[model samples]
Target: MISQNTINTVFETARVEEVIGDFVNLKRAGSNFKGLSPFSDERSPSFMVSPAKGIWKDFSTGKGGNSVKFLMEHSQFTYPEAIRYLARKYNIEIEETEQTDAEKAITDVRESMYLVSEFAKDYFHRTLINSEEGKAIGLSYFKERGFTNETIKKFDLGYSPETWDALTKEALGKGYKLEFLESTGLTIPREDRPFDRFKGRVMFPIQSMSGRVLGFGGRILTNDKKAAKYLNSPESDIYHKSKVLYGIYQAKQSIAKQNNCYLVEGYTDVIQFNQAGIENVVASSGTALTPDQIRLINRLTRNITVLFDGDAAGLRASIRGIDLILEEGMNVRVCGFPDGEDPDSFARKNSHDELVAYLEENSKDFIQFKASLLMKDAKNDPIKKADLIRDMVTSISKIPDRIQREVYTQECARIMDISEQVLVSTLAQLIQKDLTEANKKQKQEQKPFEVLRNQNPKNTGYSGGDPDDPRTGPPDGYMEEPGYPQQQQAEKVDILYRLERKVIEILLLYGDKTEEFEDVFLKSNDEGEVVMVSEKKQYKVHQRIYLSLQEDEVELSNNLFRDIFTDIIGFYHQNEKFSLEQYLMRLEPDFAQEVTDILMEDERLALHDWEGQNIFTKGKHETIAQYVSETVMSMRWFLVGKIIEELKSSIQPENSDNTELLSMVMDYSKLVNSFSKKLGRVMSRYH
Candidate 1:
């Protein structure tokens, strides 16, 4: 178990923007930072981070939370995993207590597979550097490729020995479960016996963006005609090849700093480029480009410069993937090497400056590169040239921005010696065709629901027929209660929910602020008649809100909100000072998430520069007293209205003995009027 003291230290030291910025490309927006949401595909940024509050919110997905919660949501880290990651990032030493067996058991299956994968990474790394067979085989191969000792260790390069069961036996001896070993694909299970999966191969660990080992990609040393040159770990819970990029964990910072990423084809391409001082490079691990992979890069930058080998045939095949990048609304640039050279060999042969200069001089916009490269194949043939023009227009049409599409269309016209007007016409036709197809597909998908509605014309979108549908009545096995209009249930719940939520939001934001409040009460006058009286006093915002709610005998209707209110009040009473960071750390992740959402909900308004446009907005602090009083009074008014509603429902029209119900209704109606008048006065003062 991680000690609370260490957790507090980590929370205090780690900055929310700094931690989230590693994965997101955050740009300053007033006091907050805005970036594209990592959880959703968005061209414009909707994710905001507040450094002062130590919280973040994604307006697109509505996932808001503190720094620890962001890691857990984005990276799928457990609470302890997130804490440990922050600790490592901040270089905080963790103090631990002995965990019970139940605590140990709480480590989930995915984490167990992660542990096994990590173990395999360490085991293979040790073997490559320490074992004699690894030194002779894997070490020699990496050295021949011009990899330095420092570079090898930097990437955690390793080798699996020739023996079939070397890793399997070693892992078993360490008390690692065979089930986890098989599940992670470190040990391939068989009826005869389990064996090492990557025996006699140089190992490259594939890692998550957070630097946790997910799987491995290995290369065979010998030139065996019958065997494949490379193999990758099978799909496991911890690793999905399509969703991850090699070297992203190492390249994210550089990618964000440089605002560009060099996409390559293999593991060595990533490593060689890194060793050559080009740090912002990642590989697809030889797989075709996927939307998820492109999105990984999109989180950091909107520019991609694909590094292709000099082979003409390979370039032709891989050039198609650039359309995928364009479809994502990112800029695509292409660079190729000299004939017969790839990224790995070219980097080895050139100095850092030469490689850098070569890229700058050779890199061209993807459209220009594609047209010029294919122009040779279409030489002097009108039909082929026309086909090539259409191909370029098709790729151009994939761009999401209309301005970019037009710009690329003009460039294509220039490169192909065609008229710009003709290319524009073709682009428009293609875009319209795509839209028509999309609309057709949507209508086809909705056809079933449409038919169902037609067959049952009285369907109210409910399994049990709506009570308002007199022909259907309620569905069988259900009864409609008196004075309960089912249709109004949702509206009634929403009104009270909003009121209760407002109370909680005020308590969270202004709980520690001192304010003078006018407390209202009902008291008996000297004439034995009841009268409403107001007493003015100074109290903390939380104290005032709590006492008001208690005096009215009202509680938050939502379970989560009620728990949060209780906890906030308890913290304020128990501690001399309130720290938002400290309070968030004390709550469970779910509670912490709700608290952050309530606290930072208004911060989204800061994204728009209203003040810059000569339109100003008021901060809640300027009217803390009025805001607090209004929120509490609003809750009281809403509760009193609910009481009157129930009392009115209890008055039976058919029964003779309804005198008490009538009296209660009249009394509650007077209370509602009193609350309404007080609420109106507070609002009038604020306005």
Candidate 2:
């Protein structure tokens, strides 16, 4: 366990923007920063970070939390791991008690696999530099491939010995379990014995975005026709090939800085490009490009330049991936190397500046590249030329932005020497066909749910069981008031939920601020006439809310809100001062996240450049007292209405003596009316 002092120090010292900026491309949005959500695929920016509060929220996915929580959500780090990462980043020394073997055994499977993979990465690297076989075979192969020792060490390149069981035995003797090794695809298990999966191969350790080793790729140096030349770790808990891009861990920052990524085809391609001073390159590792991989790059950039080898067939197959990228609302360009040369070979042969110049000078928009590449194959054949034109139109249609689609369509028309009218008609037909198919698919998916709705008792107007029992009187769908649908009742519930959330928001924002408040009550005046009287009193915002709610016997209906309310009140009572960072660090992650969401919900308004439009907004602190009093009063009114609802539900129409329940309803109604008058608002929803 990390000491409380170290955790507190980290919380105070580590800036949220500084930590998250490493992964997200955040730009200034007024007082806050805004960026595209890393958790979802979004073209427009919806993720906001509040540096004042040390929190971030993604409106796209509704995930929000402090700096530590962001790491946990984005990188799948456990709480302790997140803390350690922050500790390392901030250079805070972690004070800890050593864990026992029993405690170590309780570590989860995914974490165990991570540990095993890291161990293998270290073991292989050690062998490559220190062992005779590794130096002669693996190290020599890497050196021949023009990899310097620093480059080898930087990427954690390594070697596995020729003996199948060498790594397995070494790991086992070091007290690492076979279960984790096999789970990570490092060891292949058998009844008689287990052996290393990458024996006799040079290793390339694949890392997560946060730089944890998740798996490895290995290359065979010798000519063994029966054995595959390149092998990757099979899909494991921590590594899914389609979702994992080679060099993403290294390239994410560069991709964000350059605002473009270089998509390549293999691990060596990524490494060579990086060596050639292009750090924004990632590879699909030869698998077909997947949306998840594209999304990973999309988080950092909106532009991708796919580098391809000269093979005509490979180029054609890769064009399909360009359509996927276009569908994601990203700009894409393509650059193909000279015949008989791949990215790795071309990058190796050129100086850094030369390689970069070749890419910049040769790269073309997807439409231009597609048209020029296919026009040769369609020479003078009218049928082939029409097919090629339609293919280009199909790729163009995948762009989500309408303006972009129109622009690309014009470009396609010019490239194909076709009439703009003909292309537009074909594009319209393709779009309509896609829309129709999508609607058809949606209806098919909802067919079973539609049957379920038809079969429902409420839909059939048959209210279930014991109809004579007043407890089960009319169905909830049958309303007492005329012209008010059941949906309004749902809307009322939403209103209450919003009010409850508002109370939480107020407490979180101003719990410690002292303010003047009006204490109102009904009292008998001099002539024995009842009149409203108010007294000026000063109280902390949280104390006022706590006392008011307690006096009315109102309890928060939502479990999360109630828990948070109790904790905040107790924290205020116990401490002389409140620290937002300390309070966040003290709560469990989920509770802290809920608090952050509530506190930062209105921060999105700042992103609209409202001040630039001369539409000024009031800061919360300026009206804390009014805000707190109104929220509490609204909550009281909502709760009173709920009480009226319960009383009405309890009245037995079948029985004659329902006087007490009806009188109780009238009393609550009077209270509601008084609250409505005091609030200077009518309960229109109730009517």
Model 2 pairs in collision: none
User: Per-residue alpha-carbon lDDT of model 1 for 1-687, expressed as tens digits?
Assistant: 999889889999999999999999999987889999999988888789999889999977879888898999888899899999999999999999888999777658888888888899999999989989989999998999899999999899999999999999999999899999999888999999999989989999999898889999999888887767999999988899999899999999999999999999999999999999999999999888899999999999999999999997659646878999999999999998889999999999999999999999999998888887888999999999999898989999999999999889888888888899999988989999989999999999999999997886543333444443323444311322334454444345555666677787887777888888886768999999988899999999998888888876878877988998999899999999988888887888679777777776666555555567776776777889988887687777777666667777777777578988888878766776677667764322111
Instruction: Report the C-alpha displacement of residue 587, candidate 2, in angstroms.
Output: 2.6
Count of clashing residue pairs in every prediction:
0, 0
Candidate 2, which ten residues in sequence have the lowest lDDT sum?
Answer: 473-482
Give residue 194's error in model 2 in angstroms.
1.0
Superposed Cα RMSD, model 1: 5.8
Clashing pairs in 1: none
- Give the distance in Å from residue 195's predicted Cα in candidate 1 to where it truly belongs: 1.4
lDDT of 1: 0.86
